[model samples]
Target: MFGFILRRLLSGVVLLFVISTLAYMLLYVGGGNIARRILGQQATAETVAQKTTELGLDRPLLVQYIDWLSHAVTGDFGTSWFTGEMVSSGITSRLGVTLSIVIGATVITAIVAVIIGVWAAVRGGWVDKVVQGVSILGFAIPGFLIALGLVTLFALNLKWFKPTGYVPLTESATGWLATVTLPIIALAIGGIAGVAQQVRGSVVDALQRDYVRTLRSRGLSFNRVVFKHVLRNAGGPALAVLAVQFVGLLGGAVIVERIFAIPGLGQVAVTATSQGDIPMVMGLVVAIAAMVVIINLLIDLLQGWLNPKVRLA
Candidate 1:
């Protein structure tokens, strides 16, 4: 297990390096004349040339990449071209908001998916069909549409939650919940669909195994057999699927954040992209990729713990 974890961590490091390198190249190499964008269209060529030199655009690409990587490793992502603010500070301030939404949605998705999936699997017939149908709808619908529908109902009509705004968790739990509820729901709906389907399918497959029948023959109650034997055996695959969905939710947060006007990493990323803020955009991309890698590693470890066969593999 230790070796497995170490290997996964090393792989994650390699993946981050590759992703950061590609992101850096796309911004610096492909972006062309960033100093012009930063200095505005009115700025003279002499001023632009000076700014380019100051920002080290004249340096060799290899040297620039190494410099950027070294500074990024130290959490010094440099200044935003447009705002002149440090990229690290911009990202750090918004990271909490995105994390809260993603984590809250994930927790909700896990509980709801497991219950609905397991119940549908046990009952089968119409229940199973309904769950599958919901899963298809989740895959088909866009998250922003769901956000708009939710806001129209919960915010516009009912006035229960705010339509758009963000409140820090440090301020008030109630206020935070009120602010984030719609965004969480928007994010969770599709995830619940995807995860519940995986769970349902896994549980259904687990139920048909000879061991399940053997447990029933030994006079174990149906619920006990299903929960203890079936779920434990089936849960490994569902956990893997859930982890994938969680990573996807981080990316999806971008659209949801924009729709709801929430100031988060997603919002920051979009703004940075529009303004050609390479440092800020690279910071956001690397942060999201690192998060995805960490979550996937944890998932693999959990799966191995649950299934010894996985550990051996």
Candidate 2:
């Protein structure tokens, strides 16, 4: 298990390196007149040149990347080109807001999906139909629309949650929950739809297997047979789906955060990209890539634990 975990971590690190390098190259090579944009249209040519040289944009792309990477490894992402804020500090301040929504959505997706999926697979009548219908609706509706609807119905009409603004958990736990609840729900709906379907299918397949019959013949109770044996076999695919959903939730949080007026990495990402703030953008790229790599590693570890065959593979 230790070896397996080490191997996964090594691969994750490699993936992070590759992603960060690609993002750096793409941003530097394709992003046009970053200095001019930062300096404004009225700036003189000599001024732009001075700004460019000051930013080390005049250096070779490879050299620039190496310099950035060297600083990045030491947790020194440098100051933003546009705002002059420390990239690390800026991102760190907003990271928690985005993570709260995404992680909360993921947890809700896993638990609710499992329950609904298992119920649909076991009952197999109106309950199954209703689950299927809801899954289809979930797939059809975009997350942003869900966010809008939730804001309107719950925040505006019912006065359940605040329409916009975030409260830090450190400030007040209940206030934070109230603020984030709608955004989390909006992000989680689609994830639940996708993962629930996967769970339902896997559970159904497990129920039809010969092992299920064997367990039944051995006089195991229905609940024990399903929960202990069937779910164990079916859990792998559901977990895989849930991991994918978690990544999607990260992307979805960008839009949801905007709608909810939450101060998060999403706002910074949009502003940085638009302004061609390479240092800030690169910081975000590295941070998001590292997160994805870590999430994938965790999923791989869970998969290996659930199915020893996965470790062999």
- Of the candidates shown, which would achieve the greatest lDDT relative to the real structure? 2
The residue-level lDDT of candidate 2 at 27 comes to 89
User: Taking the tens digit of each residue's C-alpha lDDT, what string does model 2 give over 61-156?
Assistant: 999999989999999999998778999999999999999999999999999999999999999999999998999899789999999999999999
Q: Please report, as a residue range, the 10-residue window in candidate 1 with the lowest summed lDDT.
A: 24-33
Collision count of model 2: 0
lDDT of 1 by residue, 1-313 (tens): 8888888999999999999998888777778788899898999999999999999989999999999999989989898888888888998889899999999999999999999999899999998898889889987899989999999999999999989989888899899999999999999999999999999989999989999999999999999998888998998999999999999899899999988899999888888899888888888888899899999898888888889788677
lDDT of each: 0.91, 0.92
Model 2 poorest ten-residue lDDT run: 296-305
**Candidate 1 lDDT (Cα, 0 to 1):** 0.91
Q: Give model 1's TM-score versus the native structure.
A: 0.97
- Cα distance off (Å), candidate 2, residue 301: 1.5
